[model samples]
Target: MAESRSKLVIVGIGDDGLAGMTESARRIVAEAEVILGAPAMLSLLDGLSGRKEALEPDMPAALRQVREALASQRAVLVSGGDPLFYGVARYLCDRLGKDQFEVIPHVSSMQLAFARVKESWEDAYLTSLAGRPLEAVVDRIRTAEKVGLFSSDEHPPNRLARALLDRGIDYFRAYVCENLGSPDERVTQAELTDLASMDFDPLNVLILIRKPNRPDQASRAGRHRLFGNPDDMFAQTLPKRGLITQAEVRSIALAQLDIRPDSVVWDIGAGSGSVAIEAAQLAYQGMVYAVEPEPADVALIEANAESFGVPNVRPVPGRAPEVLASLPDPDAIFVGGTGRQVVLVLRSAYARLCPGGRMAVNVVTIDGLATALETLKNLTSEVQVWNISIARGIEQMDRVRFEAINPTFLLAVTKTPDVSD
Candidate 1:
């Protein structure tokens, strides 16, 4: 009869690896017939009794190799830091089924990284660069007040810092913690600009803590903006500017839409996504679909979404009505532009709206307003229109003069039961 295969043990290692492991953890590693780990992880267990197997950098392939070895002898798979906290333990269990393995966790380097920076990480944005794209990292970092990143070979600290700086994200004070828990452990602190040119060890965690009073590079959290927020308060496209939804118009449309804390909304002509961005804050638990046809505008919307730290707003790169088919049916729809298809777009949007949903349309042209009113009347019995003309008070000499902006028309409609039939 063949000998029964022993269960695989996945052990989390600190910067000190086996040297810092508990007695029980050390016993598991010493008795294993085959031990699997990355080159760096394997280096920590040199001259150990077990036959060491260096794991490949590719995780999926390494997992398969580990499983094959487990079929014969006692096996141990080693990982850096806490195995479940952005470490390999979760991936192994998830991929191979939980019944196949047992996990022994240690303090995560992310935790150590935060500890070294003297910041609480319970609410921080934690992510890893290992095997993930840089774009994902950049997007997450854009609005995070505190971020803990597990650096990768391709996306080292310098590369990450440069990427952030190039995108005009400079509000963070970065701390790079290397060889955590080891005697040679070092933590380097610098501004993003300064870090862009620096070098650090491959085994490092990058911690970013936002500086106080610096305009949060990311969007502010929660709804209820101060009456007059600076234009820079929002994430807007550079160069091809003035495309952001004007703050005044956004406020009016949001009010007309009757946005609740959890109201699902769509900004059909999202442009630079200012309307959808603000609406995301107001509807924290709700989702906002910022639909735009232009690719560049979609990119801007994504940047703005990250800048504002509003994960609820999803940027859909396509025209309205066409893209509307895929979105979760919305409670409110803000139509920013119709491009001569005002009636058609409004009618289609209303059809997809949930019962009692609100629709608000903003039109600068008289023709667009006429089309909006006609379309809105067909959808519901209750229709309200506001001709909003806003003028900012400018200090000229000793007198304050009102600088008038082009008047805008807001058409708001609520779905109500038709009294007739």
Candidate 2:
């Protein structure tokens, strides 16, 4: 009769390794027939009497090796810090099934790093850079008051600090914790600018604590109003600056677009592509075609897309109606500046839209609205027009006063299958 396979135990160790482990955890490691871990982890169990196996540098292969070993004898897979908090234990559980192993966790390095910095982590944005793109975690950190990052070999603290600083994100006080709980453990704190020039151990957690009173560090609403973001929030062409769609108008148009994560959209007359960029972010998996006629505006759109890191936006450098031919049909469309060609663009866009697709046209004057409404009446049966007037508060002589922006008209039309014929 074959011997029964022993259960796999995944144990988390602090920077102190076995010395910091609980007695029960130590006993489990000592009794294991096969011990699998990185060299650093293996060094912790130097005198242990077991069939010691060094884990591969590659995580997936190491996990595979661990699973094969689990079929024969009792094994302990050792990892540093909390096994589940951006650690290997979660990956193991996910790949091998939760029932296949028991996980023993220790304090995560993120928690230790935050503790070292004397900051509460309940609200911090936590992520790991290991085997992942830095851009994958940047958006979450962009507005977070606190951020905890498990720095990897490829994307270390210095690189991350530099990336953040380069993107005008200088609101955080960076703290790097190296070898937490070890005798040589060190926690270094500095401004993000200062951190970009420094170096630290490979095994480190990078904590970003937002500096007090920093303008960009404030909460979303505290920093700026919801509807009308500052014109500088977007990238615009130099010579044709301020020609981009107005914030109030874009806000109302976005609302009419009814944007969601799955929305497929088109921004005709994309200008600097503010609406298209924001819409792309809101509609993550969905597509946003930024159709612009001006080459400078198209270049600005590309620059804006890079800064925002929104991959969903496709900047098409050409006039609409003609360019709309090659693109996928949109769920919604926003016409920012159509001039006298407003009716023609709407008619073409309406025909290209899938049934139930929405199209919103922003008109600064009543004449433009009349043209759009007339075109909508001919194209589809239902059209809703809204005149949006926004007043932004300005602080003057210690008194707050409302500054009313130019009112704009938004005409929203929904296409119907029956209207096509």
- Provide the TM-score for each candidate, comma-separated: 0.53, 0.54
- Which one is best on TM-score? 2
Lowest-sum lDDT 10-residue window in model 1: 219-228
Candidate 2's clash total is 0
Tens-place lDDT per residue, model 2, 178-244, is: 9999999998989888898899999899998887877663322234333456678887767867666
lDDT of 1 at 348: 93
In order, candidate lDDTs are 0.80, 0.80
Model 2 vs. true fold: TM = 0.54
RMSD for each of the candidates: 12.4, 12.7
Quality of model 2 by C-alpha lDDT: 0.80
Q: Estimate the TM-score for candidate 1.
A: 0.53
Can you write out model 1's per-residue Cα lDDT over 103-139, one digit (the tens) per residue?
A: 9988888888888888999988887776454654676
Shift of residue 207 alpha carbon in model 2, Å: 1.1
Clashes of each: 3, 0
